[model samples]
Target chain A: MIYFKKVLKKIISPYRIAGSLFSSQYALMLEYRAEIVLWAISGVLPLIMLGLWTGAEARVLAGITKEDITRYFISAFIVRQFTAVWVMVSFEEDHIEGKLSPFILQPIYPFWRYFFSHVAEQFTRIPFVLVIMIFLFIGFPQTFFIPSNKELIAAIIAIFSAFCVRFILHWTFAMVNFWTERASAIERVLMIPYLFLSGLVAPIETFPESVRAFALLTPYPYLLSFPAKILSGANVNLLQGFLCLFLWGSLFMFISFYAWRNGLKQYSSMGA
Target chain B: MAIITVKDLRKNFRVSVKRPGLSGSLKNFFNRKTILVEAVKGVTFKVSQGEMVGFIGPNGAGKTTTLKMLCGLVHPSGGELLVAGHKPQSRNTSFLKDITLVMGQKQQLIWDLPPLDSFYVNAAVYGLNKQEASKRIDELAAMLELNDELVRPVRKLSLGQRMKAELLAALLHRPSILFLDEPTLGLDVNAQSKVREFLSKYNKRYGATILLTSHYMADITSLCSRVLLIHQGSLFHDGSLDELTLKLSPYRAVRIELKEPQPKGLFVNYGQLEEFNGCLVRLLIPRETLTDSITSILNNFPVKDLEVCDPPVEELIGNLFKNPNY
Candidate 1:
């Protein structure tokens, strides 16, 4: 009986399911390596800003050295590449192509498929990112710096957590596809605040105190700024960063499933 | 025992109305107009365990809507539905495990990966162990006559190979009930025959209940002894395939070959002239008038050969939507 139970548990385990899904999704992701390379290249904004900020004196962001700013921007670049979420675009494609129907008919929740798909895409992006970083360090060896072991581990955890928060947040918006056909247009509006406050353009510290405080209130700073700071070996409250990510991730997860239930009703009414 | 039961099932859609022309479009931009469409009126049916029944209907006749409701993809607007002793709209995991829905041309396989990769994913999702999944895959592959195609990318496969692969993916869990919509659409004659054969074999071996909808009459004629003919959002007939053709079509087709030649006009006075060439003429004479029409044509024209039979189900059903009353 114990042997049987273990078999049953293993069969139903999420790890086994995720392993199968990830392997299949990884194979599919590699087929689009050319597209992923271009996507990784497009995330060069932070590196470009690093160059611009390196020349500025202590005036740009108070209480920070030129070398620290360079490390911060490089950290931000890595964080942005790993935590980038595009569930909105993918969900819209599946919704339009009638692929969602097949997904809905299956035994598993459909978002799990999309989740593994996003994770697989991140894996595919790793090689391209390493190449870019190698070019950067070779061209300007002074920019190279090794983060402490603790800092590297914390940043990896933080970046992955931030990805969860961002994925659920964007996926919550993707539910708008069930109401209307096109929801990618809304992504453009989401970009305005995300670009401004996510520390992608510049560090949130450079902003006025009021603006920084406001940005912190939203989930934007936790997504990139907190993780980037940890990666750059800067001092940060690890507990607060993790807590904010957990709280925001939980909130969006609840709202997304609620929207999913209602979205199904609307799906049937859209002419089956 | 009835494994599937539905009563007075209905689906109503509230759709926006868009008028033609620039002026109407401009006016509608300010305030959109909308209307309620009753896509499926009251439809009721039942199928016993291991029974394979055909649900036949034209486009926009609520066939797919009804199937969607059975599989829990679409919630019913009203009425009751019970499949495998569970409410489908609840979408319980147990219920999902007991059923599967397959739609034509829409795929569940990852496009870039080989079908074998997706089969593994599906097996894991359905909680099948590697050994069990591999065993079932081998069995189904032999049954489907699938070989190396499982390892080829899905986009590279022929339409027939892709469809067979789709059936394999869907049936991986061995669901007790199957809901298939246009499963044989856009396939060659040989491919359709193979699918029909496989479905029959699967049903017999596992005693699975099937509710299939298809525009291909051959799919129904061969696989389903019983059929549910639907039209204009209502159930029209529930009987054998032959009975459906008989009820819908009140006319028998008569053909005659003249030794020489005859104008189409020469046959029209006797019955409705469906076809007329120089040597042969086809007519749809009402059953009541079939004898009189044939006699008159034979007595007048030098009939070299004569034939009479009920029209093909394809022809009868093809004209059904045009004459919804029939």
Candidate 2:
């Protein structure tokens, strides 16, 4: 009985439940091995931008070289892959199809399962990403910057924090389905601005001063550019960057929580 | 004591009305009309511990909505509901632990992976250890006769197998109360009977209170002694199946085999003639007048065989829905 009690306690604990979810999701990711490869390949947008920036050297702003652009875009590609959150599409599909009813009925909160699933995808995609990075470095050894130990540590922290912020923001938007059926359309509308402002197209520094200021004011910079900037050894205020990420992450986290609570109240589990 | 009690429970949903065609779609995009649907309107019922109750209703009569509310999947707009001594809408951990809801249309099983993986995930979510969860899975798998199917991907399994696996996933936690909505839906005759047998045995062995909703009359007839009938989002009747039949139908079907060819006109005075062939006849007569009608029919006609029985449960339920006041 004592052993059983211990097991029960362990299983019910949030941390253990999250760990189990992560493991199951990791296994699921393995089953989607081909899809993982396709997703990783999809991150080649930044690499293509790198080619564009390298060819248009005259268009490049002062103090930014072709090699610098290469490193910046490569770091952005890595950050983009790590921080990717497909929760909007998946959540919309699940909501539309009534697949979320079972999760809603579970004892554990449903968000943790979704969170673990995305995190597990990232964990599974790490090796493939590393392989790509290795190939890139082998081809253009001059472009890649090996960060200092301290910088590497800070970059890891920033990237992880960025992933959290992006996940929460995407989840918050996904909750729009609770009120309307056009959540995917809304997400598509939001994606255009996000693509420009999140440094997916170009680094924030490459933008005009006014646009750069506006981008920094939004949460998009902390989600993608800040982490990429950290990894590229760019001259950035580390303290300000971390603080901005934390503030935006907390804001989005609260919004997501609020959205979820309200969403549950409105959720009819219609099809099920 | 009643394990589940619902008093004046209600649910309302606001639905957006969309217009058809490009012009109407554009108009809807600007100003969409909305309507409120009263899915469950002031339904009330109670189920005591270890009692298997059937919540029978026609489509859109709020059976699924009520079940969803009891399981904390859908929130009630008004009224009170208590399941296992907890307010269902609160969805407390203890309350959730004590109950499981199974909807045949929705599944918890991971589609691409073996059911064992999903079972382990449910075990973790429900706070069951590896050893205990495995033991319970084994027991349930054995009961469900899902020996090899547990290891196969859920998508690969037949519908019956998938539903059985879904049941095992739900029951692994050993919930004290089970809310089954259309649990035997979309199954063949053999699979349906097998599912009903398993459910009856499970309830008996575990003493779990079960509230089931199914369109199949056989499901309710075989497993539930007491049933709540809902029509138009209201509880029309709550009693034993026999009581419901007697109350709504209040009639017996007297099937008779004639000794010779009988005129259909001759049997009309006995009762309402339901069937009349060359040498066979069936009549629906009021229960109170059953003896008189049978005696009269026998006295008038040369009867070879005769039997009196209540109308089929399906017909009785059908009549009840058509005219709920009965």
Candidate 3:
């Protein structure tokens, strides 16, 4: 019990930092509520793809019913809404403007600030996502079915894990800003793979066998398809999905940490 | 004990050269050329605890670079440096807790949030409990003369108020060592004086060591007794401000209101006659012979009034930077 208490204390210590960061960031997000609405509205790619798929009458491909397509895309929209990552652009700006210096001087790792800000922004998007969901259901009441309690819990955990994985992946690339000024160009390059392979456009199962195999080998499908599949009530290997999430999270965490250490050596506090 | 020490500190940056036109751009893009620019070159100095030292230099003379190195914002290309018994580059948590840095051009507070909110966030990161953070905020707020300004969003506050709030945030942890880069940059005279007074009081009250860089000489002349002068990426002089003035400009401006107008020849051999209009006269007298010259003028001429003061330090330092031979 003593050992457990000590471990719990260690865990709770950072909760203070997280709490303060989240509250302030949430307050800041509220100030940019207009921009948040636009960002939330912009993430309707999954719904747009659903419309494209159904309008073409290809929604029943490979035993996927029309209702299944609607639910899948709707779930995918929610996943994308919550799992969006843009730390790269934000990090690049701070790194270039020398606004990162104060964070670096503090005792905590600076990534926590970005992480909490992302989470806070996600919280701020909750209402808009709900409002969009209302419009989505109004358009197709057939897709308004509620998820089961088990699926709801599982999807939440998986979606959050996916967000973490995506954040770390982008943060790893964001470290390239230390060496080059145009790191955002890499984000544009990443968009090609993310849009096509992450099931944001179509269900992974609809892809050809070889293509599905190749996409699964990358971390992109798990970032979107796996959680949306759970919410869509489709069959999925929960064990394998979670194991891949853990492995990819670990790999990117290690790589990002290494990049961060190396990047600090090259940081000269530009524009300071 | 020396809280900060340096030996042959150096930093170099490699900047790429770009060409203008399309053909030149294509050629450059195909085969880019780069040159290493030494921002700081073998600069060496030591700052002991409780000492407020001024670091002065021209725009590109590496003052900010040296401060960046000391605060671990940039790793040194070469040198031995120790701050509070830790290598700054290592950036140990303990070392971080022992120091704070403030850049006037940049701010740490969230722009949309009130400064008090940012202060709480910083407090939490620094491990201060709520009560402790509040008490410290109150104390610092009083010191900075900030009242309700803390509640206003940072963007809404005037530059001076925002900077005061920034200082409150930076000093919340009360680190023993401070590295301030242009802390008084872009502030009006009143704001600058207020900041200087607060810094002076803080240094005396807490005995905290400060290494500050500024374009405003008043910040240095009013606060720091010792000044470190850097020029062309090197430490040119490190001593008392008065000593620097004596070394750089050995002349004082002597203004006199004579009872009657005098000829320029009457003061030709005395010194460099700066002005001789009507009954008023001005001369730049050498420091060594200033006493004798003043006596001769007082005795020989019907001097109605005489006032003596050293030449402006900024003019001297500015001229020195403009021409190294100065």
**Chain A accuracy as TM-score for every candidate:** 0.94, 0.92, 0.95
How close is chain A of candidate 1 to the true chain A, as a TM-score?
0.94
Please say which candidate is ahead in TM-score: 1 or 2.
Answer: 2
lDDT of 2: 0.88
Alpha carbon lDDT at A228, candidate 1: 97
**Fnat per candidate:** 0.70, 0.72, 0.93
Highest lDDT: give the candidate number. Answer: 3
Instruction: Write out the backbone clash pairs for model 3.
Output: none
- Show model 1 residue runs off by greater than 4 Å: A2-12, A57-61, A269-272, B21-25, B254-306, B324-326
Model 1 chain B weakest 10-residue run by lDDT: B317-326
Chain A, candidate 2, TM-score of 0.92
How many steric overlaps are in each model, in order? 0, 0, 0
Going through the candidates in order, their DockQ values are: 0.58, 0.74, 0.86
- lDDT, model 1, position B103: 86
By lDDT, the better pick of 2 and 3 is 3
lDDT of model 3, residue A87: 91
Q: DockQ order of candidates, best first?
A: 3, 2, 1
